[model samples]
Target chain A: MSWAWFHKLGSPKWFFSWSKPWALPLFCFGCLSLLIGLVWGLVFAPADYQQGNSFRIIYIHVPVAMLAQSCYLALGAAGFVFLVWQMKMAPVFIKAMAPIGAVMSLVALVSGAIWGKPTWGTWWVWDARLTSVLVLFFLYMGIIALQNSLEDQVLANKAAAVISVVGLINLPVIKYSVVLLETLHQGPTFTLTKKPEMPAEMWLPLLFAVIGLYCFVAGVVLWRMQSEILMSEHRSSWVKQEVTKHGF
Target chain B: MAFNSLTEFLMMGTHGVYVWSAYGFSTLTLVWLVWNTLATRRKTRDTLRKRFLRNQAR
Candidate 1:
C-alpha cells in the first residue's frame, strides 16, 4: 500500500481543505440518528420489566462511555505517532480531541452515577470499573492542563504526547475491570463474539445511538482540528486565502 | 408507544427524574461542544482576516 496518503494527511493545508466539506453532512446525519435513537429508546421501546424507564438512560450512557474509552485510545495512538514520526498533525489531533474526550468521560461518569441511583441504590461507588473511568477523566484533564500551561508549543506538544502515551495503561484496566474485580458495574453489553443479552427491541435503537454519537463526535473533532490548523498556520498564504474566501 | 399518555411518558413510571436528568445533561454537553467548536472557528477566521487586512495596508 502506498504511504503517500499518510504523508498527505500530515499536511495541515491538505487536511483542512479535505475535511471542510465533510463536517456538515456528518453533523446532520449524526443529529438525525441520535434524535431517532433517543426518542425510540425513550418513548417507543418497551420498559424493562425490572428497571422500568430508568433503563432508558442506557441509550445515552453506554454510547458516551464507549466513546470516552475510544477517545483515549485515539489519543494514545496519536501520541505514539507524534513521538515516533514527529507528525505535526498528531499533536493537533491530541489538542483538539482532549477536551472532547474529557467531556465524554464526564458525561459517562455523571450518567453512570445517575443510572446507579435507582439500579444500585447508590449514587457513586469506588469499584474497579467506576474508579478506573474516573481516572481516565483525570488523565484527560491533566493533558489539557499541561497543554494550556506551557507557553512553548514544542514543549507543550511533547509533554502532552508523553502523558497521553503513558496514560494508555488505564484503557485495558477500564475495559476488564468488571470481570477482573467484582463491581457494581455490569459486564459488557455489546460484544463482537456473542450476541447481546438484550432483546431486539432494547438493542436496536442503541445501535443507532452508538453510530450516531460516533459520527457526531467525528464531525466536531474535524471542525476543531480545522480550527487548530488555521491557528497554527495563520501566516501561511493558503490559510489567508482560505479565510478570505470564506469571508467570515 | 411505551406509555399511553404524555404524562406517563414524562413520569417514566416514577424513574422520570433520573432518566430525564441524565438525558438533559448529556444533550447539553454535546450541544455545547458543537456550539463552542463553531464559535471558535468563526473567531479564528475573524482574527485572521483582521491580520491579513492589516498586513495588506502596510
Candidate 2:
C-alpha cells in the first residue's frame, strides 16, 4: 500500500480542504441518529430485569464513556506522532481534542455516578474502573493546563506530548479494571467476541446511540481541527484566501 | 411505546429522577460543545483576518 495519503494528512492545508465536504454531513448524521436512538430507547426498548427503568441511562452513559476513552487514545496516538515525527499538525490535533476528551470524561463520570445512585446505592466510589476514568479526566486537564501555562509554543507541545503519551498506561487499566479487580462496576456489556448480555430489543437502540455519539464526537473533533488548521495557517496565502472565500 | 401515556413516560416508573437527569445533563453538554466549537472558529477567523488586513496596510 502507499503512504502518500498519510503524508498528505500531515499537511494542514490538504486536510482542511479535504475535510470540508464531510464534516457537516457527519454532524447531521449524528443529530439524526441521536434522535432515533433517543426515541427508540426511551419509548420502545424494554426495561432491564434488575435495574428497571434506570438502565435507560446506559444509552448515554455507555456512548459518552466510550467517547471519553477513545479521545484519550486518539490524543496519545497524536502525541506519539508529534514526538516522533515532529508532525506540526499533531499538536494542533491535541489542542483541539483535549477539551472534548475532558468534557466526555466529565460527562461519563457524572452520568455514571447518577446511574450508580439508583443501582449501586451511592454517588461515588473508589472502584478501579471509576477511579481510572477519573485519572483520565485529570490527565486531559494536565494537558490543557500545561499547554496554556507555557509561553513558548514548542516547549508547551513537547511537555503536553510527554504527558499525553505517558497517560496512555491508564487506558488499559480503565478498560480491564472491572474484570481484573473486584469492583462495583459491571464487566463489558457489548464486546465483539461475546454475544451481548442485552437482548436484541434492548441493545439495538443502544447500537444506534453508540454510533450517533461516535458521529457527534467525530464532527466536533473535525470542527475543532478545522479551526486549528485555520489558526495555525493564518499567515499563509491560502488561509487568507480561504477565510475570505467563506465570507469571513 | 413503552408507556401507556405521556404521564407514564414522564414518570419513568419511579426512576424518572435518575433517568431524566442523565439524559438532560448529557444532551446539554454535547450541545454546548458544538456551540462552543463554532463560536471559537468564528473568533479565530476574525482575529486572523484582522491581522492579515493590518499587515497588508503596513
Candidate 3:
C-alpha cells in the first residue's frame, strides 16, 4: 500500500468524509458481536469448575480492562501525531478519547473489584495488578481534567497530549508490575509471550468481546473526530457546503 | 446451559449481586459513552449552523 494515504489522513475534511460510510456498519457489527459474545459467555459457556457462576464477570472485566490500557496507548499515539504532524484533527481525537478512556478504566476497576469479591474474598487489595490498574484510572482522569481545564483548545490538546505521553510509561509498569514486584496477584492469564491456559470454549467469547470492543471504540472515535472536524472547520467553505448538502 | 432454570440464572447461584452489578455497570458505561459522543456531535453541529447563519446574514 502507498504511504500517501497516511498523509491524506492529516486533512480533517478528508478523514471526516472517509470515515462517514464506515461508521454505521462498524457500529452495527460491534453491537452484534457484543451481544453474541455476552450471551455466549454468560449463558452458554460452562461455569468455571472453581469459581462457578461468578466467573461470568470475566466477560466484562477482561474486555474493559484490556480496553483501559489500550485506549491510553491510543491517546499517546494521537498525542505523538498531534505533536509531529500538527494535525488539526489529532487534538480533537485526543480530547474526545479522554473521557471514553477514563470511563473504560473506571469500568475495568469496578468490575475487577466485583470479581475480586467473589474470587479473592475481598473487595479491595493492594496487589500489583489491582494497584497498577487504579493508577491507570487516575492517569486517565488526569488527562481528561487537563484537557477540559485549559481555555484554549490548542493548548488544552497540547497539555493533554503531554500528559498522555507521560502516562504511557505506566502501562508497562502496570503489565509487568505483577512479575517485577512478585506480588499477591497471579501471573497474567493472557499474554503475548505465553500460551493461555483457558479452554477454547471459554476464550472464544472473550475473543469476540475484545474484537467487538475494538470496533466499538473505533466507531466512537470516528464519530467524535467528525464532530471535531466540524467544530474546527466551521468557517471553512467545505464545511459550509457539506452541512448545506446534508441539510444540517 | 449453565443454569437449570430462569430463577437459577437470575440468582446466579447466589453470586447474583456481583455478577449483575458487573453487567449493569458495563452496560451503563457503554450507554454513557454513546450518549456523550452523540450529544457532543449535536452541539458541534448546532454551533456550526448558528455561525454559518450569522455569517450569511452579514
> Which candidate number maximizes DockQ?
1
Q: What digit string (tens of lDDT, one per residue) describes model 1 on residues A1-248?
A: 89998998799999888889998899889888888898999999999999889999999999999999999999999999999999999999999999999999999999999999999999998988999999999999999999999999899999999999999999999999987898988888899899999999899999999999989889999999999999999989999999888653
lDDT of 3 by residue, A145-229 (tens): 8877879877888888888888888899888887888665556667887677888888889888888887888888788878878
Question: For each candidate, C-alpha RMSD in Å?
Answer: 0.9, 1.2, 1.7
Alpha carbon lDDT of residue A114, candidate 3? 89
lDDT: worst 10-residue window of model 2 chain A: A239-248
Q: For all candidates, what are the clash counts?
A: 0, 0, 0
Reference contact recovery of candidate 2 = 0.74
Global Cα lDDT for candidate 1: 0.93
Better of 2 and 3 by lDDT: 2
lDDT of 3: 0.84
How high is the TM-score of chain A in model 2?
Answer: 0.97
**In candidate 3 chain A, what residue range of length 10 has the lowest lDDT sum?**
A182-191
Provide TM-scores for the models: 0.98, 0.97, 0.94
Best by lDDT: 1
**Which of candidates 1 and 2 is the stronger one according to lDDT?**
1
